[model samples]
Target: MSTGLGWRDGRAVLSAVHGRRVHEREVVPGVEVGWLLGGPRRCIGAWLEGQDERTPCPHHAVIAADGAAVQCASCQSVDRGLALARDQILDDGRTYRLYLAWFGEGLLKVGLTAEQRGTSRLLEQGALAWTFAARGALPAVRRAELTVAASGLARERFKSRVKPDHWWEHGDVDHRRALLTDARVRAHELLRGHGVELLADHPVTDHVGVFGLTDGAPDVYRAVEALADGAVLAGRLRPPIGRHLLLDQPDDGTPLLLDTRLLTGWTLAPAAGRPSAGLALSERVRPAEPDTQEALF
Candidate 1:
């Protein structure tokens, strides 16, 4: 199998699968990988080395259900320093755009990204709806992000759990559109008040169809808990929602919400039986259980 994982365009893909076959060129659509047999073999400490480099250190580390990768102790110290100096390290001479992304209901976040990447950033973030509020040089965009945060209009990140269940079940489209429009209006006014150039003409992105929730869309999975190391996940994959991959399990017919990040730094092999033997999707997969002695204390 391939040695590592990487993000292309706006999708999480496997670099290699059984037999050292490399998926270098094609974006292994979430649906494709979800249908395969295999699961996380082990967790490894991984971190981004540069703006475009992902380095997987061979150290056993804890992987979160939400797909957050935690590096080992030594790596964590280095990562902390890198994060503190991120502004200096990532300062390539490029324009950045400020955006307002809506997840669901009242969940929204304001963030900045390189102008040229466009909506790919939003797609990677799994935003249900988003609109550009302002565009400027890096410093100006950063200032606007801080201004928006200070005003309590939005933050830098929003959790995916805030999203409504079965997003397309009701009049979600129209209601979501209304919410985005209002958010956009408020964002524009706030940016303009802070002297940031308003981007009133940018189109709003609606990702209902992108996640395959549109009419006649294919079946997808919804995971309840995280996958443990050595747990084999076998199912048909659907387009991801945020960093989550929806898998349709063959045996129990249950949907699973898998964090794509868990796939990084893993070496996967095809499992032996149908339904991958003991690969049952259950809510029991948790980060860790509390100790009985600790509770008593």
Candidate 2:
């Protein structure tokens, strides 16, 4: 059954984010029905959380644009703290791998995840190119991330809409790999200079097969700025690039790149004909104009 909610374990499910493009019989059954109906028949309800709780509150309460659930202010506070402490905890309590992820030309980010997650974490972030720079205990990985950031090698995060479509098309994988390799070499030197132990060699991976890298221009269904709460979004869903969704809006033959994060704290239901609920005044923000430039590097 489709619940308007797409989040699971604090991450958006790949199928829900990609819409009809990703087919996993286990998660989404009757693919044809979903495609024919524009997307999964689901609805978004309230956002609920509890103080120091590992699970969401069962109240199913609505939330604000900033993701604060008015009905559960205490939970919201706890959620914020948990977000800050995420790096300190891992599900399996195993070694963590530190990575250098490259986006458009020169865009890089330093991140750490459980060693067992493999490429899953990278995929979730929609990294155009990435490589594992080091692996070690949590403290070591944390230190590596701090050192990389302090050395000006990369940032901790990037804007969701900053990614330009051109890089995906005209981007050269070999060139990117070369850049990553060079960065890796420099990173190792920097770590050693800081007296940090070098745990392992970097492992590189490209997202071409997973994200469908192409030179063809994407179809624009609508601009992200035009979306409003209770605005029923329906159409052919394209593979996600980073956290953005390329939706082919049926009302008008336009393609739009929507940030998946925007769907995080809302109640959503399948768009049968029109939206049945409205967003709170505080939840609405004017969307930004779509980027028309070549690249955001």
Please give, for residues 81-147, the per-residue lDDT of candidate 1 as tens digits: 3453365434456677889887755567898877787667787777777888888777778888888
lDDT at 175 for candidate 2? 78
lDDT of 2 by residue, 5-48 (tens): 23233243533323223222222211211121221222232222
**Model 2: per-residue Cα lDDT at residue 35:** 21
Error of 1 at 55 (Å): 3.7
Backbone N/Cα/C clashes per model: 10, 16
Score every model by TM-score: 0.71, 0.66
Give the distance in Å from residue 96's predicted Cα in candidate 1 to where it truly belongs: 1.0
Q: Give the best candidate by lDDT.
A: 1
C-alpha positional error of residue 206 in candidate 2 after TM-score superposition, expressed in Å? 0.9
Which numbered prediction scores highest in TM-score against the true structure?
1
RMSD of each: 8.9, 8.2
Model 2, C-alpha of 185: deviation from truth (Å):
0.9
Q: Score residue 232 of candidate 2 by CA lDDT.
A: 52
